[model samples]
Target chain A: MSNWQWFHRLGSPRWFYYKTEGWVPWLAAVSGILLVLGTVWGLAFAPPDYQQGNSYRIIYLHVPAAFLALIGYYVMAVAGAVGMIWRMKMAFVVMKSAAPIGAALTFLSLVTGAIWGKPTWGTWWEWDARITSMLILLFLYLGIMALQAAFQSRDAADKASALLALIGTVNIPIIYKSVDWWHTLHQPATLKLTSAPTIHSSMLYPLLTMILAFYIFYALVLILYTRAEILRREGRTQWVIDLVKEEAKKP
Target chain B: MHPVRRQRLFFILFIVFFSSVAVGLMAFALRDNINLFYPPSMIVAGEVPLDRRIRAGGCVRPGSVSRDRETLETTFLLTDGIVDFRVHYTGILPDLFAEGEAAVVNGELRADGGFYATQVLAKHDEKYMPPEVAETMAAVSDGHDESCEVVQYGS
Candidate 1:
């Protein structure tokens, strides 16, 4: 029971806020460093792909954005599930905060993919299974965000968006399997969980680093957004008011 | 867990499970139309309808490319290692378009079985390596074809 205490404590807005307060700058610095290192290494050091040449370097951004866009959806769905099941206000806030970030990343993935496609595939867009499925993912994120904004009551908004988020989880597996399940213009995954990566070590290492950087960056933004939401939602509470007063009193 | 909380968790699980099943059935039902292109084998079997716009994708058979030079008229053979067909296009090809590479062509099927392509797109494989590594690989496996083996057609 004691071991699970942290889980219950995490449901508290004040506890979550103070716990993540000091982590923002640290995460920002680490993610920033990794992003710069990975980008530079991928761009300059990694050899040009034998077939595609330098255009392949965009994988550093495209793959990471696509990876996190899919992952962020699951994170949002799980948080929504927790809120719906346990009535955790913090979980609801976290779920609400994840929508725009996931949407932006999905947009980034699609744009980078288009830019990469023009030179490689000879088309800026295709109705291929993989590309269509990824576009659907962006729409799913946008739908959840729109649902959250549509309701008049906060509780109603939370429940409605949570249900939609849960239902949208169906698309995640579909997006992942679209390339394999159907003939697609897009190539199959370069990195596989079960097998060694198809890419050479020079290209794979920086890509792996960029993926890690994106995950940390996602966490950092999620925490920052959730903290702000907590403050807004809990503004009338004595704890939040006192914390604000304390901050105001400081030089 | 509290009884109400346990019930809510189960309810959420039920919703997710049923929705996924519904989506899965729809995907299975529409599987054929979902594929971006048909393999040369399917077209060779006469399964694909004629006089309609459709896509066929396969590896560009090595030594099968011939160009008109003056015009953009170019012809090459596409194969799935099981069946081979020719694709004719009259436009600039992508940079990666080459012999032994995967390509998808969209247009109509000719009476002679060749594809008259309005659009031609190159499809690369999952493998990525530097030119030096590729040269070494070519040297190590002279006369052995490894490119076409990586591409699989949708069944």
Candidate 2:
């Protein structure tokens, strides 16, 4: 089909819902498998850093979580924008589904970074640029979630939250560039498309694999959450009622 | 304004206040990156230039630690495999620091490569020792004392 037609279909809640239903289980399975394999490869097989030795292994978890935290915010912001601009119900569903997950990933990044920092930088915390910006990102995610829950009307809440998300996007660039803009003890980017990786092949391979695995996991979870949101939002629809009844009939 | 718009305005104001404070702190701490990492061996070799912010790292020499009579300062020797350099700091040490432990000091190098430290970091925890230290100990201890106690210190 044409690109516009494909996008048009995606913009429809019913079409998006049915399409995702079939994909979620497979995506979840693949995500789980890749995550397990990648973690083992990173934790055990990867050679230790020449300087840091085994403690550097924490980067596998730290970097991936940080990457996902930033990416999740973008996902939320873009979804919010789409919902506001096009008045698409599915877009709202996506925005709502993304916030808590993004918050969780951001929290993971902060905690893992703190743990890794203790061994390498000698302190459990620093008010460094990247670290500080990431903390703000977490608060932004929390704010969106809280605003949505505080409102009585779902539509009004979604619109308000989306606007907040769009505004909060200013911090995303700040987070990405904080290492350069300010003096941070946190090392610069290890993986860059234009330059060679700073690490050895043995270590870099597993890190890349784990990053890919993280993206797949995000997609899998997003789909699952979106499906749940669909069920909750469309619970009054005949199809949803029928599905619920059919499931009830099952042994 | 609509209730949604009013709510958004409040959120925006809140974010603005926090972001400005974060940015202000970051700008104040800005410094050169290369100046931030130095091993004691590098310092002894006069590799770090004087009066520039740099980090010096090495194992804390077993018996070279002494406290300053006045001020929050302390003096100790940091040693890598081949060389040792004196480090002086006037701030709080990280919680994990102790004799024979690995550490990294951030500050400036003197003209003579003696490090005048602004910040100090103990390298690892009891559960997570730096590999460099473990390897050094392993090499030195070869078939000797295999029962050396792992070090831990409370902040």
Candidate 3:
């Protein structure tokens, strides 16, 4: 089949289930390997900051987690928009699966950031613009989750949640630019397109590696959750029923 | 609502409430980050121990600045007129570090009556004040007398 033919077939629940089952284990294995390598490289091998010393090592986890949190929200919002526009049930499932994961990542970012802040900034929390905005982002995610659960009908819930996700996306750019707009204590972006990194190559290498590892881990988890969501939503279909029958027969 | 639906809603609320409390506790546990600022008089009175990491804020006393060429350490006196404390810092001074300027230093106190600073922050008034400083100013200015005049220091 052509690529477009395969793409079109993916919308079919059975086709998606069969295609993703073969890929999930490999993706999970690769994600685990990369994460371990990245952590070791960042925590042990990388040199410490001249100013912050060993405490700056937290950046390896903190920065990647924060980056993923933001990106995950965008992914969920886009998926929601697609579901709303195309009236695709699978897209809605994907959005639903992505929200909790994104919120978890956002929570992780805030926690890790606080841990890092304690040793370096001598404080656990700051109402800095970026931090405050990120907290609001978490609230938005919870709002979507709550709105979805509030409705009596599943379809109505999905539609309402999708709309909320789309509207909340307006805050993303504001969160990104808050530091520049306000006189914040939090340092400006370390990685920027216009200028070279203010860090040594030893530190930069591990940071980049950790970022790649995080992306892979995100993809791995997203695919897993998507598969689970598809199973739960499409359990009444013949393929799912047959798969369940086959499992029971094996025992 | 159905029983299952109600339970799920309760579960989510539980998570939200529990997580919020956890976050609050973490913030309180890490209160050191929020409670860093101290006046020079507090340092002199032994209210703030010299060995502990603390921030000292006051005006730099004119003619009290000296530098050691061999050690790269600089010594200066900070005063609020009620009391004064000598601050000794080793390393490059902030650009704003000069005679008669408002400054905040983060470091430990020496066995002697001086501060061995790890970080030196120079603050200017409205022109170059950080957001935190601006917020602090706003909070303090709400009902207090406005005798505190912020001076411009290094860039």
Clashing pairs in 2: B35-B54, B36-B55, B38-B55
Of the true interface contacts, the fraction found in model 1 is 0.91
Clashes of 2: 3
Model with the higher DockQ, candidate 1 or 2: 1
Candidates in descending DockQ order: 1, 2, 3
lDDT of 2 at B108: 81
**Candidate 3 chain B lowest-lDDT run of ten:** B143-152
Candidate 2 lDDT tens digits, A54-82: 77888888888888989999899888876
**lDDT (10s digit) by residue, model 2, range B1-155:** 45774665566556656765675565456544423345555577676678977666667776788887777679998776457888988876765577776776778887765788888876542122334544675666421111112322112
Candidate 1, residue B107: Cα displacement in angstroms equals 0.8
Give Cα-based local distance difference scores for all models. Answer: 0.91, 0.75, 0.71
**Top lDDT hit:** 1
Specify the highest-TM-score model's number. Answer: 1
DockQ of each: 0.84, 0.11, 0.04
The collision pairs in model 1 are none
Can you tell me the CAPRI class of model 3?
A: incorrect
Candidate 1 chain A: 10-residue stretch with minimal lDDT: A187-196
Model 1 over residues B46-78: C-alpha lDDT tens digits?
A: 889787999999898878899997997999989
